[model samples]
Target: MSLLPNTMRAVAATGSVPLDDERALADVDLPLPELRPRDVLVEVAAVSVNPVDVKTRMRRPADAPRIVLGYDAAGTVVGVGSEVTLFAPGDEVYHAGVITRQGTNAEFHAVDERLVGRKPANLSMAEAAAMPLTTITAWESLFDRFRLDASSGGTLLAVAAAGGVGSILTQLAATLTGVSVIGTASRPETRDWVRGMGAAHVVDHHGDLAAAVREIAPDGIDRVFTPSTAGRLPLYADVLRPFGEIVAIDEDPDMDARVLKSKSIAWLWESMFTRGVFETPDMIRQHELLDEASAMFEDGRLRSTLAREIAGIDAAGLREAHALVASGRSIGKVVLVR
Candidate 1:
């Protein structure tokens, strides 16, 4: 009954290399669904490249020579494993995958029912493709990492707000929490984008971030949500209020973060894949978060971060997108549309 190929085309990492200076993709054959009882076979139409994809592919686990390379995806379900209750054949869905599994940089993918969510009705596959990775990261940082309460008033700053997760996180802070949002974007256009997404203010990350934030908030920032680990510690130290929290989702070994202790500030690192990787008792929390996010999108409280759409689901396109993201110049999420 499946009208799908047995072997899917995936962009694989032939060898390891640094994302900035090397070729990570070498096209290859990846085994398609042979289906599990609770899986959904999705025909991927659009996918987004994240830093994780760039890093994992660049570090090609020499042992496993055929790892597919994407996480965020938007597609239509083509086949349903017997016990799939939330979706059926012909449903449109989007999700960021489990870190331990094969990814969405393929023609087709098989995923668990618990990890997928309905694509936003107002968005295209490319638009919806941008939400999952950002959503998961922001949600984890705000609610879990910082332990901020939605009913309490707080002030937060997002360093590098024009990036993928920061864009969405800005809006999430506005609508979900009782927090005043100050987003940092150096460029004029990016600053506008951050403010349009409901940020109370936009500070230039190019200037002294601490100084810019102080000119605007004068007192101090209660929390700093950083989607990048680049240049965070030094810039934030001066503006963080006592007991302020800092959360970063990027993988950077350069961060010691211990200096924050002098101010009684807390530093937190977030990774959404933690639930799926370890099958945490709250493994199903993603399902709940996606449901809530969907409602936010439906109610007009949340917006898609999709910025650029690249055609084709091939190695060349992915390489280009990865290069841009690795370059640290992109203003928002980029999607590879099939």
Candidate 2:
């Protein structure tokens, strides 16, 4: 293994401040992360900002230690823990690190081998960084939570299909399954982007969502994949078929799932962190799925959803990325590359 540095440059959230505040994120020097038995140390080449990062920043306690906030990353492995068997000193990899650990918005990050995958040969580090978290969320939602397969045929309504998770979910549904995808997009650019991701149809989600979806899928949706579920349950209940399933990635504490009971519809939540956070028996499934997805990416079956890229891994760039994501108007993913 190469001689690792004792300290590295990183950007951490100093406090729960608005994006406009200069103190929101700051550059600092931190000691290298200690590796556990299954950990692999990666020299982070690129890191992508997700909604979780923004939420975490906003909710950060003022008195707490500065928190490095990131999830999706693509990089080269420089060192491995004693028991790491999947990767070595020179593997190019990508992963969505667990929330419990220090994040990937740094010069180097240590992650579990089970949560990492060899980076796709066809993609740039920034492109690959755009995928891990969203890809895992979408993959688990479709195959794990909903249990949809290549043979399952039906109309799937993908809410906010222009967003990160929605973009990948639309592609996976269109490419890997027999389901016909009807993606929701509020803007012309987003609608076009969703169509490029292989959605069979695109509808505006701005107003009368159920009516717009009904125009494309009159019979009712067989499945629904949503990033946000707040105040949308009634709309879902109106559009979903009997016994249909809705898999969501976002949290909605006020969500009344009772509305779906009348239609016998199932509501499920997909948190990609579940396996890693709980140290589940099948945590390694993330690695397997990412490897499978890598092949798909190399073969042109799957594509990266990177829409914007910032040049450096610094506080300024991350704050800009955070602002873009928080605006809730950005399409696809925003990444910062070193």
Candidate 3:
């Protein structure tokens, strides 16, 4: 087999957004890695678009030369750093790239062994690409935030349950715990999408979430996770039982926590990248969790969340994917094969 070549092309934002800013994530030159110890050089095969890309592109520093703009990907490792212990050359892997680093929107990406995991055996690279970001975000939010026991019984309420994160969150929680999942979605198609992901019950977010949730059980839910951008707290607070915990990945400056007084709620903001950012002792936990999740996928307990698989890796496909996520109605995920 031919060894992978150095140097690659990638999509990068050279200016600010509103993408109309003339240089928002166009094609750019990227350097290849020099084979750092304990690192793996993966030949990128596919990537997924998440809300973070859109947000980063919208707020990227204008003066930077050009910022690579993707996080989730699946690829074959062409080279492994000398000290690497887990993956070997030729192993296929999927992971969410570190935030401060150049992304996998290129032909190759050098990843820390701690952030990547073996891709599921049944999934193609495109299918595998759709999972990492949503799965990483959802897994950390519920498992890390609540410390949920794998065998515990509880009711999980997922707000905005048709989006990428919600889709995986519902399935993972449902499969890992005895918890019955109740997911909220407003549209008929979204309702079906959430149901297909293993949600035991569905409520419309358009109605009073508390009322809609109460209709299912007079007793409120045990845990809530929302990936919503705005007006999320009150909705979660309304349906959460006494001392029920809630977590969100988004920060709305206007959001007030005072409303959480009732239920003696535990509300937290979850960022999957926090461990990596702080170099916390548990940064390797992401690697372990993704491995476990992949095993579940292999076991047929969890399904891939990819909804749309676009062909070819390029700026136009990425832009279209980003727009779909920004529209807030996308169910599952979108993957672009390189």
Candidate 4:
């Protein structure tokens, strides 16, 4: 702690502007964040950009203070709070920080130890950084929302299976449970990528989703996982069996729940930030799940979805990364490294 610096370099959203605008993100100097009772300070080595970063930047008010925006990070512990127990100085870790705090796009960051995990031995910082947020989201969707397990036998339809969360979700379902996975991807490359991740089938989302899914699973799907629910609930209802479930991560203002009433289909939302944001008693589950995922990664049962890496945690690089992610076509995850 005595060797720690007072200030650190960071990248932040200076104003709510388009990704191409120079004012969208900028380099800044920030004081080292204060550690809370259960907090640990980390020296960040790599961070991955998600869709949340782009959304936050675009939706932020012009008068709001410059806010740093990043979530997924892989780094080394450098300092610990009085109540911290899970990590010590020099321990390498990875985490997807809560949305309530300033983020991980900095030289140093402070995060709750309950949200951190030991970095997988086989992964580089960039690769590990690409995992935390997507991994948590996907894991919760399958295990917590859908309640699938090793004994569970069914068919799962994963929309956008080549995206960050979908890539890991497909792998987890295929490897950890008895379910068969049908992934949706429009492009040839992404379809191949989804299949490589362990999907039993890959269908074109640009075509008739219900018909395509029916051709593969004639009996109807047992579960559906999607990032977006805009204007697609009816199609999901049509393809899901009676008493099936749908887990989604995005917000859709026009979504109607009545479509599933007749079939008794359950529609659930999965937000990895819920436990941390509310300081729920079960917040520590994130730590446990991440450690479990680490073991899976180390044993070769899971793999990193890092598709692109940019050098340095600077505003220019982050802007490029953010724009790529905002394009809605980038496969897997994009990371920035020091």
Candidate 5:
């Protein structure tokens, strides 16, 4: 009764190595994943590499089984579990798969239905694949974590605005809301890319972030969103207004919250995997936000941030993508087409 294949090729991490080392990535044959009660089996058409894939692989145990490494993916639904109701066979969809499970680099991937959304009709599979992880991170950061009102006008400083998540965050903040977004980039090409994403102001984070931002907005920034918060905690404290909100997706244990003590700034972490990882009561929120993003993309309010495209979906392609991301110079997202 099922048309699904028994095995497929997947780009997996063979062992820990330098980011650009091709020997660390391999194209391996794997058995198809079993579907959970709320799962959908997706025949992957395209997938994008995120920094998480690179970071996770770097710290992976040497003797651990080869692990597939991808999160943002677009594909067609070929099968569904018993409890799946949101999608049917043949439906085109996209999702940022959960962190705990095997990922989306394989030919076929099994993902929870609640974390999947209909693909934007206007975008290609590769373009669609570039969105999920960054879109979800940006959406959740703006609405859920910071809880900023769309109608309220304030300055927002986005650090590393040329990167995957920051690019989308800049676009979302500038287009969907009244926020004045200031993006930080260290390179000319990336600065242009950030400005092209609709950032009102682009400044160099390698220089004085606070001074450059203050030049544009005499008043201090009301919110700050960044992927890294390691050594920049004190900078955030200086740039943010009193009682402002600061949200980051990366984990930095060295960051001391007391740095913002005088300003009473609110610090929060936005992990897109929280709902899927914990199976919380509001797990369906990812579905809701993703659907909204699809609609926005269809209506032309939002555009795909896919900047680089690779030809293959094999080990070599995976290594190339990981190397690009590690360079920290990618303007937007790097997607590998099947």
Candidate 6:
């Protein structure tokens, strides 16, 4: 018998607002989500705020349903859909769910089994919650979108080194491949953090990105990865070697393909939700990647990028997290726990 209640409390967007304020997110009662085939009902133990959460809440229409805006979560499976085989009741898991579905801000969330992975045994729920969204973004950008081989032995310039995705990407590039990582961080603390994350060199993004990267790579970067690529695509084009790859995972509506024409740079975009949103045949790749990440964490090869932990899983805590993320100054990730 399931212990789930008919209703659960969720930190939800009451209305769209350009600024993060106390009223931005509120505690509301929502009916427990009904499961679809291959879905698992998770008893959410922890959730981490991402830039996507802040952006989605800020742009949501006021007339839309009260939106729950979390993407990354870790919890125990309380129930599973009929076709679910990867997990069962009582299995601990973590995932970054598709944006098309209800989010993980609620006390309970239903996620596709193919998008979920077993939680790393060595990390707590809060730590595991911090990894899903950022890790998936970084991993897919390097290995999938960029198609970087393990022994590529090239240089990579990662922009915004202290942010959620950049931190993990820097570490992954440094440890998992022969890539010489140059991470961009403007502030002193972020620069130090980037160095600690295994960047061979830390450059200030507020300065000339191309000049700074050239100082390190000299010839030019072999690859570039960034989460905030809007308006900065040309910087990558200027610094990247001819035929080098640039992978961006954020919304780049104004990005022009002409910028990379001269360099013959291959520009690619990686959205972590693409497979789940399209229900692609390779949707289970996310599961495989997270599972590999879990093993890496357990083996002490990778560390969770959880920087701060908020005490409660409520509206006030979520609002605080949103403000931190919106400020664009958070070191790693801000998590809320029950």
Estimate the TM-score of every prediction. Answer: 0.92, 0.98, 0.94, 0.99, 0.97, 0.96
Over the stretch 1-338, how does candidate 5's per-residue lDDT look in tens digits?
Answer: 16777899997896677655665888889999999999999999999999999889988877778788789899999999999999999999999989999999999999999999999999999999999999999999998887766686888899899899998898889877899999999888989999999999999998988899889877688999988788999989888989999999898878788999999999998999999999999998898889999999999988999999998888888888888998887889999999
Error of 5 at 131 (Å): 0.2
Give the Cα lDDT of each candidate. 0.82, 0.93, 0.83, 0.94, 0.90, 0.89
Tens-place lDDT per residue, model 3, 1-338, is: 14555568888765455654446657766778666676788889999998888888767567766778788999998888889898888899998978877788988888788888899998899989999878989888877887876777878888888888999999988877788889999999999999999999999888777888898878878888877737778767776788988788887889888888967999878988787667688878889989999999999999898899888778777777877888888888989997
- Residue lDDT tens for model 1, 1-338: 45566687878765466443334576777778566786888899999988777677667654456667688999999998889899988889988878888789899888887788888787889988988878988888888897766795778888788888888888888887889998888878898999988899888877777777888888888888876666578667778888888887865677777778889988788998988778788776886787789888888999888888899888888888988888888888989999
> What pairs collide in candidate 4?
none
Q: Model 2 over residues 107-164: C-alpha lDDT tens digits?
A: 9999999999999999999999999999999999999998989998989999889999
TM-score of 3: 0.94
lDDT of 6 at 277: 96
Clashes of 2: 0
Model 1 alpha-carbon drift over 4 Å, by segment: 18-23, 61-64
Q: Candidate 4's residue-wise lDDT over 32-71, tens digit each?
A: 9999999999999999999988888778887788898899
Model 2 scores a C-alpha lDDT of: 0.93
The runs of at least 3 residues in candidate 2 whose Cα sits more than 4 Å from the true structure, single-residue gaps closed, are none
Q: Sort by TM-score, best first: what order?
A: 4, 2, 5, 6, 3, 1
Q: Which stretches of candidate 6 lie above 4 Å from their native place?
A: 18-23
Of 1 and 3, the candidate ahead on TM-score is 3
- Candidate 5: the clashing residue pairs are none
RMSD of each: 2.2, 1.0, 1.9, 0.8, 1.2, 1.4
Return the clash pairs for model 3, or none.
12-25, 13-25
Cα displacement (Å) at residue 226, model 4 = 0.6
Separate clash counts for every candidate: 0, 0, 2, 0, 0, 0
In angstroms, give how far residue 269 of model 2 lies from its true place. 0.7
Give Cα distance to truth, residue 182, candidate 3, Å: 1.1
